[model samples]
Target: MYVAVKGGERAIEASYRLLDAARRGDPAVPELQVGQLQQQMRLLVDRVMAEASLHDPELAALALKQAQGDAIEAVFLLRAYRSTLPRFGYGEPLDTARMRASRRICAVFKDVPGGQVLGATHDYTQRLLDFGLLCPDAGHAVIQAASGAPVPDAMPSALAALAAEGLIEPQRPSAGDPEPPDITRVPPSYPLPRTARLQMLARGDEGWVLGMAYSTQRGYANTHPFAGEVRVGHVPVEIVPDELGFPIEIGEVELTECQMINQFTGSADVAPQFTRGYGLAFGRSERKTMAVSLVDRVMRADEFGEDRTSPSQDQEFVLPHSDNVEASGFVQHLKLPHYVTFESELQLIRALREAWDARTTVPPRSVEPSTKEVCAK
Candidate 1:
């Protein structure tokens, strides 16, 4: 279960040097700045931040640079860096309803409260590569330009309307406003509460989440999810000081949230109402947001009396395996020396083979004719 890796100090140091050179490819070319990575590779930074559960964009960009653009490796670097930092007090739950939305869309309703603002999305753009991006001035490369319009002060959730009609399931908090368990602070056990589960999903690997969510679409869990609403915006992060005894806005972080509406059972099967799932992540991650939302709905199969027919539906299966850091460490550990364990296996196999040969090759003791039979012959 553990790697008993042994190596020479010289060899390890040499390997480290080689890795440094590999990370800094082609020194003759202009080195990439942290600012350039922050602007150009914004999505990469976002993914690292989400996976690492760290909010700093600059560090995320630096981690990506250090890891040579490997998202999982960048996440590992970021998480390692995060472990050293001191913990401040927790922030108040962001009121996403009052968020300054840059993009908002809802598949359930065509005419939402604020209308569908496409924002800076490539959804409508042509798939062809624009070679104009290679030029010094890449500003004009896009098919459409930003209108430079101000977003509304707040965009009400599309779910609000559905809730008013009593067609949607309620997600009201319980009494006493209990503090949610932080996975970083507490070791998780299965059958986690919604809050802890949501926190884990927020930091889960994007690729794995997408695969799990896609399984539901392909008739595995079959939630029949619609994009109830997907909002991308920046929300203020507030901290309540012990002395002050009131929350104050420290800063803001960009977040992408998805509220997926699923129609699992019809009127014949159950009451004709829609179930809702929530997903929130750091920065403008649409696919991750949608996937997390879909998976979240499937995870609630027990509450809604839906059958647990897929891996995604099982929280035990999903949450424990979704962390890329843990998964990557485990898989990569195979590269380490397992010579002692492997040698034992080899010896066992050889002994078994030798025993088989001895059993098969030994001539059956010649049936010695009984004395009477020999005499008769």
Candidate 2:
């Protein structure tokens, strides 16, 4: 055991050294710049930032490089780093209606008011690989806008149309002001509020969220949904300064927003109408946003008075297990030393066996011959 442990320690040290050397590559080769990663690997950086719950691109890029391009590792690093930073005041809630949309589409509408603007998407592209990228080209292809048609600043949501027709449930503005609970500050309990649920879903692992969403579609939640709007764009972030009473734009962040219209049966005074599920995340993460919407819907099964028969509908099951860092940490803890506990268990087992044998064992005793046996002899 000592020799094996020694060998393992040496191997781990060597592996780390090799990793550092490999990260730098050959001396002749130039090291990768974090700026390059931030700009070129924008989508990957965005994902790290979103999952990390921080919106710093440069830090995300640095974490990505240090993690050897592992997104989850980068997110873990970023979250750790974020813990050390001083907290500025919280920003105002974002207004998606005012977003300068680059890409907008609605599954419910064939022709939207602003017209569908497909920008930098592979949705309609062929699945075959292009060999053209292997070769370098000096010239770039130019894409011109439609001759007389001008794209609108924002596309109208199909939900608005449904609401106008009274086919969707009304979302009345809250009479009292209530700030959203910060999960980082205060841990969540069961029956999480909408804000807490959304916060958890926003930073949840993408693959897990996707699976949960897929399960709902496969009849787990028994949901039928239509994409009210899927928008990717830049939205202004604002905050009110202590000195200044009015709010001012701090910056703009690229975001993906999804609104899913779900069917609902009549309840009490409320007629049968459509209800909406919403998701918003940093940058253009369509799948993540869509998954968030679906999970958000399922998590609200109780509010809709739907039966919670699926794992996706269980808040206790989903919320705690969704965090990759927490899940990874707990799972990886199995590799840690458990000798003391195991030795204690072993001792208990041995003692139990001894007692059991003693109880079961028959001791030799003087036998009294029965009258019937004596007669047979």
Candidate 3:
């Protein structure tokens, strides 16, 4: 109790010093540059950016370095910084149909319009680790091989072909198409719209989303899906300036987009057609995007007349718990002092124990012999 309460300002200042020393490690070693993190640990940077909902690679790398590579901590730092930045205006939805795709594939189709382009995946490689990578040149050579590969001129979606044949269900905007609510600006209530749910899941922890998606695959949810198309590329962002009446290309952002074709036997009102689940993320995170897409389908159970019995199908269970930052803060709060609350419980337990001991220790009350027994004696 003394350490927990009385240490106060001096203790915190000392702890900060200790942390700084720990982060620096051996002074003999050269400190890691931010560019090294951005280039070498780019995947981590991408994850942090997506979770934080910020698109700055350099800032994400800096956050990762500051947190000593603790991903959730990096996300927390980045998100906090993002809150301080001024917002200019919202960008319009990206036209992904015209994306300059670098990596494109379709599991459902034997041959897509432009054929499968395996740009930079480790998917086909043997799972065994190559000890050759212990040499610096070997690692560089491996990455260099993946660079400058030929890409398709016109990589088209396989789902578009299906939709043309009326085998796919089309999505139309809601009546009046009201603007989607921003969860960061306003807290979300239950029965969230599709747009809001998508926003929440995209900003969710990657691991949690993956687990939820895996649950659906393991028969937790009745979702029969195929990888309709998975594409990675850069798409131009357009924004209409307040002064200008029309849109203008701002800049290009790297993205990974996934479309999952789900089996949907139509309800009474409609004919049977393939439904779609979509996932799009800030950078080339195929694993994260695929998981998000699968879960997206599971989360739409109610709308598609499917059972809401699975954990993946419960919006309340998924949306609120998906954020690692919020979850980490809450779970880590247990380390903080709860002296008053614990003391109250301790007194209660002490009183209860005393009552129990008194009840058990008391000699059985010797009642006067029953009148009938006395008479008999």
On lDDT, the candidate that comes out on top is 3
lDDT (10s digit) by residue, model 3, range 1-377: 23566658798889899998988889998898899999988789999999999999999999999999999999999999999999888899888887889889899988878888888778999999889877666776556765565676556677778888989988677558989888889799998888898888888999999999999998999878899999989899999998998999989898899989888899988689898888988888899899999998888887778888899889999989999999999998888888889999999999999999998896877788899999999
Worst-scoring 10-residue span by lDDT in model 1: 1-10
Each candidate structure's TM-score, on Cα atoms with residue i matched to residue i, is: 0.90, 0.85, 0.92
Instruction: Report the C-alpha displacement of residue 113, candidate 2, in angstroms.
Output: 1.5
Worst 10 residues of 3 by lDDT: 140-149
User: For residues 1-377, what per-residue lDDT tens digits would candidate 1 score against the true structure?
Assistant: 44345556667789889999998789997788889999989988999999999999999999999888999999999999999999876888899887899999988898988888888888889999988778876775453554667779798887888889978877788346678999998999888878888889889999899999999999999668899999999999889999999999989999999999987554455677888888999998899989988888888887767689998888888997999999999999888878889999999999999999988896757787899998998
Leading candidate by TM-score: 3
**Candidates 2 and 3: which is better by TM-score?**
3
Candidate 3 wrongly placed segments (more than 4 Å): 1-4, 143-149, 361-377
Error of 2 at 186 (Å): 0.8
Stretches of model 2 off by over 4 angstroms after superposition: 1-15, 25-30, 136-150, 173-177, 345-377
Which regions of candidate 1 deviate over 4 angstroms? 1-7, 140-145, 174-177, 264-271, 362-377
Q: Across residues 272-362, which tens digit of lDDT does each residue of candidate 2 receive?
A: 9888888888987898999999989878787778888998998888888889888877887777767788899999999999999999999
Scored by lDDT, model 1 comes in at: 0.88
